[model samples]
Target: MAEAAGCPLSVIVPALDEAAGIAATLEPLQVWRERGAEVLVVDGGSGDGTPEAAAPGADRVLGGARGRAPQMNAGAAAAGGRVLLFLHADTRPPEDGDRALLTALEGGRHWGRFDVRLTGASRLTLLGLVGAMMNLRSRLTGIATGDQALFVTRAAFRAVGGFPEQPLMEDIALSRLLKKHCGRPACLRERALTSSRRWEDRGILRTIGLMWALRLRYWLGADPAVLAARYHRG
Candidate 1:
């Protein structure tokens, strides 16, 4: 993989049992691959042929430890790029997102994330509000979530020791560490489209409440293992 400036970029997608949407998720990224970006799909022991489904679109399809943090770390370890972008299985990057990320780095930011728009069966109005609130919160707190498509330079990532190996809140943890090492994120205006199934499955308001509660507990020193179980149960 090679960029015009000799700075290679790698997009890492960590998935588990995502065979149903893996192809769609990787499709748009092919354009980036054409531009010398290496696209890697790290699967967490999916029994549904996710690896095979992902192999055609990705530069490398890797088997990794279960959980987003570990799987993403595995991808980072195997990536050959000077810059890394962590994308979720259900998220779609904006047009020219690869260039956007690289441009942000070129402008001297060490790490950044795109704003996100939720897409699914939910009403557009409510979803729009949720997406706006999320973007606003991230900008205010200088924290980027995985759904926002977080990107970082190799040096910054190494300085922060990568994402913490936790079951939940790994993105939040990584953001906090990155902020300390590299300052606030770029917080790009471009939006990545993330699935709204999380909110749609459980009423939108309920999902919001649950997420806030989980964060509050985590901040108060709750065990990530327990939070993970509660999140899954919901």
Candidate 2:
């Protein structure tokens, strides 16, 4: 059970080879933990000292299978909080993110997600439209992306069987299960700011095309492992 105003939240960051920004990504949690939030950095075999970088600020740096779904599942298993938040390593939660999460949980919903903002000044300027579109579309469809900072009650997460342990689309996949079992997720007002490294590294237009193609293929029942191959290759 949770309080009317706030509840203990466990923030799970699934990381992989993210040494460059892993420390910075987790540093905010020092304050969060003080405020009753627990932070876990679930790393999936990074060669670049990502786990070491996260150790300074994270409540726990846990190793797991090399994939976001499995890693996040591992984090959820070790969580001690009432609510479990799955955060991407490259995304930063909003100020007072724990409060935002607690607020979301009180609204007669088992799960919810924050909107997202892409970071980097120029990148934000260029991708602002894309981010806005994603937020609007996600709200309408009730399918949240991982960068959006999806959260669910521990009971609800277990009820839905956690993430699918697939190679890709786990966030959307989880949303689908929640939709069937729990109804539409509460869409929060606060937004998580995520680095635009994926779009920047691959060129925005090209990455956009690749994402659409991959999604289309996945919708057409293409194997996730095959789609993940194309995604990683791109």
Best by TM-score: 1
**How far off is model 1, as Cα RMSD?**
2.2
Backbone clashes (count) for model 2: 0
**lDDT for each candidate structure:** 0.92, 0.87
Best by lDDT: 1
Tens digits of lDDT, candidate 2, 152-172: 988999999999999999998
Q: Pairing residues by index, what is the TM-score of model 2?
A: 0.94
Q: List where candidate 2 sits over 4 angstroms from the true fold.
A: 1-7, 121-124
Q: Please give the lDDT score for candidate 2.
A: 0.87
Off by over 4 Å in 1: 1-7, 121-124
